[model samples]
Target: MSIWQDQHVTVVVSGGIASYKAIYLVRQLMKQGATVRVTMTAHATEFVTPLTFQTLTQQPVFSDEFTMQDPKHVGHVALADWTDLMIMVPATANLIAKVANGIADDAATTTILATTAPKYVVPAMNSHMYANPATQRNLAQLQTDGLQVLTPATGMLAEGYVGRGRMPEPDEIVDWLTQTLIDQQTDLPLHGKKVLVTAGGTREMIDPVRYISNRSSGKMGYAMATVARELGAEVTLISTPTALTQPAGVQYIEVLSAAELLTQVTAKFATTDMLVMAAAVSDYRPVKAVDQKIKKQPGQTGLTLELTETADILKQLAAQKTGQFVIGFAAETQHLLANAEKKLAEKKLDMLVANDVSQPGVGFNGDTNQVTLLTPNSTPVTTNLLSKTEIAHSVLTAAINRGA
Candidate 1:
């Protein structure tokens, strides 16, 4: 399930040109399955109407404490009580000052004051205003009051000046909020654990212009990295060439070849609590890479190149394993379980994820996969055809159950 499923999110929009952006943020939250209610400052309504937010959230937007739309209970207090998480997007300089000084003249401030739920403040203003001593002091005070404040992005502001104080993009805000919520769950299965994941297909250089690579799109590995982070593990993704975005809050290291992948994994193995080797490392590389691109002769009929074996990363990791739980992937076309089991035992892996690439929608370059989880002395658990994200959570759950 999505982390935001059934979550009650209260978005408090304050006055700023960035208030329009908050509409997009609210839309994203609802898309993630959050039941969102919006509270707008009177000035905020000038930027975006309450009717817009009310229509989008399918709930009444609270702007005044005296307004009695829900006659039975106080609107601000009721909303505050129902909120699981509260966020102030485009937290203007005035709102920050009011909040810091315990001022609650408006519905938004009143609800903020009433809620015991964790609060996240996203600041947005002119660069000079944000950098002012009073603003900085109030922000620091908010942190001291136990509120989480996201730093404003450094870029062009609404005033046509380029500097700090641009509100972060909607997607980035969602990612940050997601990570914050996940980190707050100390009881998550992988909490306090450090996970290292390798992703994408390694490229083996043959010449300046040519190389050997595989069809891996890195979707599965990227899913694993994202899920691991959501499970509260400190995740590091060592990746090869792929067109995927780096998962938020993950440490990303990009490498070019099997040799680089092996070196990076080896360096980090001892400190990691779990290792997921999902990358498709090239098994062979050209014996000697040409300094320049090999020219195609006009009359050439055939070309020959010598190849040599690349380092066996899994084997090397297995030999170096101390207390870390290691998981390996086997993408096979035949005898999938048998081959995966052999590798699991031979490489001392704690678990193995096996999938048949030949099957449609099962593996390699796809968003969906059907995988079998194999562990020492445990019955193989096969999952239904599911998205890579679902498969990632399943794999992590199995790993945790196996004492990873």
Candidate 2:
């Protein structure tokens, strides 16, 4: 029901009679719109055939560490990268220890080691094995390393003697996985919403070589764009050239001057649900241009210059704002709130994010930022200095909560 639709989940099966439970796990995961793949340990294959799992998942089952089929490629890494989440249902005590350590003799172990995605382990073994000091230590280490471990349920086991080593039922595992995916989804709160973000400082060319531009490095704005995409928004980032890579999943439109950004923003205004005016646009441009790079004579110390007003894209967008939420950013040194409030109203914006650029380690090219979100209704919400990723989550959450 969420964006995990058609998401990839790899299920690793280990040696245990609880391996039968994986049949239903695959069924429930498929019912929830997930593309399921299975990998079995050598002993696990004794309980369930690779063909059986392949038939259930409608995908190939991988169980080999080395393959003569492709000597040049490692299938484990390929499977690892293909997975969004790696899950071990009926995780054996042996497998747990292997995962806790860096052992990678088996396909499952090797894939988990190579995979960068979030991993989860569903432990299923005998009560004695589950309570073993070694197992407990391994589990602790796995958790310390950020792995999600689902506790074994108390019930009957295949060995007929059990206290708390039974694998959780398939339905319950599905519910847990569903909740886990939902948590990941919230990181991108604006998912499915369209956002237009203008970033970086606009330059106004004075001559062939000389130009006027602000000290804005476009870091904050680029961070916002990265966060917006992470929060699931379809972001169109209109930016000036910077030493930053385009954020994945975001559509980037390069614009060197204020007029070009304005042109791109207007063209896509109707489709955007929110507009973040984070760009530091030049207020004016040279009224006249020279055919060649300006050269100073030995005695020349100054030159008279003429300037013309540049296009104000934020004001134009705010004026045409219908149901869209318009947010403007004020990077100020003094009278932050007063200037922010004034700009908020003058630009007809719904909200304004203000930051003290003069403060050290809080703005510009730095990776961290501290800012305040000012709403027209009340006082501003101050944010602590945080990594751009955290700030993006906070901003998107606030915007979504405001129903913007």
* Per-residue lDDT of model 1, residues 1-404, tens digit only: 66799999999999999999999999999998899999989999999999999999999899989999889999999999999999999999999999999999999999999999999999999999999999999999999999999999999888887989999999999999999888788988889999999999999988998999999999999999999998889999999979999899899999999999989999999999999999999999999999998999999999999999999899888778889999999999999888989998998888899999999999988889999999999999999999999999999988998888
TM-score of every candidate relative to the true structure? 0.94, 0.59
The parts of candidate 1 lying over 4 Å away from their true place are 1-3
Pairs clashing in candidate 1?
none
In candidate 2, what are the lDDT values of residues 1-404, reduced to their tens digit?
A: 23446889999999999999999999888876789999889999989898989999888788988763356667898888899988998899999999999899988888889989999999999999999999999999999999999999999877886589999999788767655654467555675689999899998888777888898888777877866765567788999999887765668999988888888999999999998888999999888767798888899989888999998788888999879998888889989888988998888888888899889877778888898998878779999998766676677677878897
**Alpha carbon lDDT at 130, candidate 2:** 96
Q: What is the lDDT of residue 364 in candidate 1?
A: 85
lDDT of each: 0.94, 0.85
Worst ten-residue run, lDDT, model 1?
Answer: 315-324
Question: lDDT score of model 1?
Answer: 0.94
Cα deviation of 357, candidate 1, in Å:
1.8
